[model samples]
Target chain A: MQRIRLLKDRIARKLMLSLTIFSGLIVFIMAFGLYQRSRPILAIKPLNELLFSTSWQPSSGKFGFFPFIMGTLWVTGVAIFIAVPLCLFTTIYLSEYSGARLCKWTNPLIDLLAGIPSVVYGMCGVLVIVPLIKDHIAPFFGTFSSGYSVLAGGVILAVMIFPIIIHVSSEVFRSVPAELREASLALGATKWQTVKHVVIRKAMPGVIAAIVLGLSRAFGETMAVLMVAGNVAKVPSSVLDPAYPLPALIANNYGEMLSVPLYDSALLLASLVLLMVVLSFNIISRIILIRVERNIR
Target chain B: MDRRYAEEKIFRSLTFASTVVIFLTLAFILATVIAKGISYMNLAMITQTPKGGYYLGKEGGVLNAILGSLYLAGGATFLAILVSLPVVLYINIYSKKESKIAAFTRFSFDVLWGVPSIVYGAFGFTIMLFFGLRTSLLGGIITVSLLILPIMSRAIDEVVRMVPTELLDASYALGATKLETALKIVTRQALPGIMTAVLVAFGRGIGDAASVIFTAGFTDSIPYSLFRPAATLPLAIFFQLGTPLPEVQGRAYASALILTSIILIISVVSRALTGRFTRHVVK
Candidate 1:
């Protein structure tokens, strides 16, 4: 008791401690609720069946998760594919060639684009982007009559995530201590050579991290993807196919499911996937942060 | 020299051309939305709930939707602050040795921030259905709170750690009570920073469509009961756009513009608040 008094007050510490537990109680409770719901409700009997089964029929009490999971991965994967390369090239060009005056105007425009709400993107897609794709790009595929294809959704998601990847990678590139650029330039290297050889390599990990973060955001994105992706719960053969990702399925189905166990389980199962992805994203970004900070003088 | 200049000219043009293509599309989108939506931004729109087939010309205004946005976002933001601020306070004050549980709490918070809003919506809807509050404002509020809790707590946690240890020691040496010290001294200093988190949470709450999708399903009429389904601007847009009707379609664009403008306003305010607070804190 004397030692406690000699130290700072421990009694008050106990109250704050309770506060900490209460804050985390919901995440704990929700996670527990999800696990409890996972077994019987989802009918996820064998790991292979859960992973491989194609049909997801709630009417017949057959709940196979393969298609929806594949859809999410495919859409997000396509988004990343379209986004990462363009943003990388854009970042490199901006870092190496663009003037400060131009960058001053350019960078914040991207931020504004980034912060524009997702629903607006969905609306724009609904009105403008979808039609443009339908009229122009989807004809290239020549398979779909109307263009609510995975390709169109991925294209929009790519545009949506572009700012994130560009912003993060450009920040990383800008941090590479201009001395490196100057040194490469001094060695008679062209500006393009200096950037490609020096800046891109140095910032690669951060760029990867940024792309992964963008991937995570795209994976969990609901409103924009839901509005545009032509929510047919099927597997996509190409980027030009219509589909439903896991988030869309949950949003579309939760209302009409008359207390069905499969309904609850499918939603929970989707959430578990979302949870794994977002956690992986944070950890990857943190690793990049660790490495970036470690390398800094 | 002439060849190099020509090459550089081509590179610069390409760079400018690509940048313009991307940003010009964005500008065109914003301009169209604003120009189309501004006509509907009447006082009635700010205050009243219209019945079926609401038109700016006919049904008076979007008063109910605006107010519902405020009510839902305001309640959710308040609830999140209530849970988050105290937890961050505990994290700030707990002596390193005594705070293993606090450490664990923070570990979960990191995970929570990344969880998709739809998942929260799903989890929340599950519970609300169990409790007989399906598709209600209460459900919406709880879901948004859960969504923002981790984000605000993390922001608040970082801000609290900036309060100097010297201040803490001095307050303790003077025999100020722990509550007094944390509340009066540390929190007062951290107020601007904490307010940034609150503002951020509010902006996030307003912007979210995902968290409230299942929890706050759309209704044509304004909800008189917390348990009744309510329409927000985002949900309204989703419904209007999703419908097969053309009239509902035009309204979706106008409504989407309205919804997006609200989120933009919120984002600008939060960013400005954080900037102002950062300046204040640095002083």
Candidate 2:
């Protein structure tokens, strides 16, 4: 019986170790699989023409990714531009100004925001933000829009990512040692000065990591952006103009992808682009986060 | 001196305003979903599947989607736990704390956790094509399990890592093997956290639509087999809203309300169960 127990223990350890190894290799497998699926498009169209040309007539075998890529950049850029300051301000207040009771009360709310489905956000955008923008904001700016524009997508996405940015940067701010704050106060620095100079400075790298994580999330958000961005298939000249992002392209055109020659491969290539960009951003943020954790230790 | 004080006041108010703005955004989303959803919600919407011409504004329910979401998320969560528990256990129990392989494994999970659901959907489609498998419930479960495994494992690993080394040493001195100690002591100590992680992953899997859109082809009827197409709530909302009819769009809001209510219930249940399970934990 003892020998049997020993054998069981050995078997369990080996099983778990192999599982761990498999988990580590799964990321690479996903990337390679996506690449293989996208190989047909790469074979037919040169990389530069596929990436740089603006025409997207799939029925005629013309698949240019430039407009979609531009749409992604514009929307993500606008989202980050709007979200960063709001997230920074929220993080500073929650970490430094709020009482523990207040912070405790807020934590669940942030998690709730994070847990809400993307489709619901999209619905809310359709009901509220879209009409507001089309009726009020665009008119105020002396522009015409259908309310389904890059600005609308960016606004909704900015809100969606607020929880991610706040949750992370607030944790980063919390880990800034209390002694550092106290020491700054003892030297006659104001609370604001201490926050501006000491706490923010100390948490800078982690804050960047948090923002990068949010950026990656915004880059690949499909449902919410797809709902409000109008899926226009054109590069927007302004925020009010309708634009179709890469993820939106994949989601919108995927149903009939098999009917058109090379269409499926093109959509698969879009996902590959999304995967590569998101994975790279994740890696960058992970490196910064690991370094920050090491320093905290 | 006056200028410094003025600057402090300005910055403080700005930060306070921003914090309020975020809270207000959450309130706005909740209120909008509830208000719009309530007007269209009905008993039949939860009890029966879509009838013919349902998309054309006929009467029917999202029972097909409701049941499908439950089964897909449930199966995915179970599969994820089966895989995640072992991977985390290996790192925390079978390997050294600072082992290079363990660190690398954690890093890979973190990266995988950030991969987009849409990409997962596409990759799942790729795998399906290779196996000559059409879109079905099994594809959704496999894809969603892959999507949530990193989330579940990382969460459980964090909790298990907090189990004291002294507890393990005591078990070892009592002639308990590492396997026995892990199953009996460490798992018990981390039960509450593990439960929370499981629920969190389940909520994510259920709420996710992009990863399942192609993998789980929508059906008006409930899924009865793993190989059959399954409809999910998020996709139901998406398709319903895509219609031109106001009534159909109203149903979309109703479905959103249902999804939101489910997540709220999950959050509450996770907290309640955590309290109940913590009775046996040492700390």
Candidate 3:
């Protein structure tokens, strides 16, 4: 009986360890799958040509990814610019100034914001942000936008990432020891100065990691960005210009256009690009976060 | 001193104002969805599927999507738990505390957790093409399971890691096998956390639209089998809002409301149940 029980335990351990190994392998498998699907287009066109070409005429078998790549960059860039400052301010306030009661209310509210579906954000963007941009902001800049500009997408994405950036940044801020803040104050630094010269300096790496994670989230955001970003296949010259992001390109054209030869490959290549970029950003951010945690300890 | 105090006040207000802006934004989104959603909501909206000329202001409902989202998220969460529990249990219970494999597994999950749902959709679409599978509920479930597996594992792993080494040693002192200790003691110790993780993953799976858009292949009717195309709430809203008709657009708000309500309920219930289950937890 003892031997049988021991044998059973060994078998169970082997089974579980194998399952764990298999789970880790899945990320590589997904990357491989995307790459394999994208192989045809890679074979047909040089990678540089495929990535940098301006034209996106898929009908004649010309599939240039430059416009979509730029579109993703522009929208994500604008989102980072808007979100980072606001999030930093909010995090500073929450961690340094706010009372525990305020945080008690604010944290759950932030979680709720994060939990709101991206589709709802898209719908809200259509109703509110798009019209605000089309009628107000664009005209203020002396330009006419149909409300579906890269600016609109950026605004919506910025809002979608607000919860993420704020949540991560608040945790980062909290990790700065109380002793450090007290020490700064003992040296006669004002509250703002303490935050600026002490807490912010200590938490800079963590803040950057938070922002990078937010960047990855913004880059891979599909439905909300797709709904607002005017799916024009051009490199946007300004925030007000309509642009088609890579995820939008894939989401918009994938299932419906299998008949278009090389179209599937083109879209799959877009997916591969998204996968690589987002994964790298995530890995970088994770490394930074690990380092920050080690330093905090 | 005067200059320093003035600068501090200005910066303080700026931060406070930004914080207020976030709160106002949250309030605005909630109010808009609720007000617009309530205006169009009726019993039929949740009881019947779309009918002929539905996008043209004709009578119909999003019952198909409501049910389909439930089925798809439900199945995916189940599969994710099945896979996640084993992987996490193996890491926490079966492996050395500082094992490289355990560390690597956790790292991979972190990366996977960050992967976008659209990539998953595209990857799922590619896999379907290879297997000659059309968009179906099965595909959606599989893809969503992949998307949520990491989320479930990481959440569960955090809690399981907190299970004290002393407890495991005690179990082993009683001659309990590793498998028995894992399944009986560590799992029980982490039950409340596990409950929250499952609900969180389910809420995520249900609200996600991008991963399912290509794999599920929306239909007007409720899906009857795994092989059949299924309508989901987010896609239902997407399609309805795409139409030019005002009535259809109104219905889309109604659908969004339903989706939001389901997620809200899941969160609330998770919190409540976690509290209740803590009675059984060791700590």
Which one wins on DockQ?
2
lDDT of 2 at B265: 92
Give a tens-digit lDDT track for model 2, residues A1-297.
Answer: 888878889999999999999999998888899899889999989989999999999999999999999999999999999999999999999889878888989999999999999999998999998999999999999989999999999999999899999998998998889999999999988889999999999999999999999999999999999999989888899999998999988988768999999999999999998999999999999999899888988
Global fold similarity of model 2 (TM-score): 0.99
Candidate 3 residues A1-297, lDDT tens each? 999988988998898888898999998998899899889989979999999999888889999999999999999999999989988998888889888889988987898888889999999999898899999999999989999989889988999999989988898888889999999999999999999899999999889989999999999999999999999998999999998999998889865568888899888888888999999999998888888878888
Clashing pairs in 2: none
Candidate 1 lDDT over residue span B1-283, tens digit each: 6676566567656656666667776797788678766654555555566655663334544555656677888889899888887778777775573477666677678667667788788788768856877678889989988888998899898888889988888888997766668877877778777887787677678778887888887676666778777777777667667767665566666676767777677656765665554443424
Per-residue alpha-carbon lDDT of candidate 2 for residues B1-283, written as tens digits (9 for 90 to 100)? 9888998999999999999999999999999999999999999999999999999999899999999999999999999998999899899988998999899999999999899899999999999999998989999999999999999999899899999999989989998888998899999999999999999999999999999988998999999999999999999999999999999999999999999999999988887777778777887
Clashing pairs in 3: none
How far out, in Å, is residue B6 in model 3?
A: 1.5
Model 2: residue B236 alpha-carbon error in angstroms: 0.3
Which residue runs does candidate 3 get wrong by more than 4 Å?
none
TM-score of each: 0.86, 0.99, 0.98
Candidate 3 residues B5-50, lDDT tens each?
Answer: 9989999999999999888999999888999899999999999999
Whole-model lDDT values for every prediction: 0.74, 0.93, 0.91
Evaluation by TM-score, superior candidate among 1 and 3: 3
Q: Lowest-lDDT window of 10 residues in candidate 2 chain A?
A: A246-255
By lDDT rank, best first, the candidates go 2, 3, 1
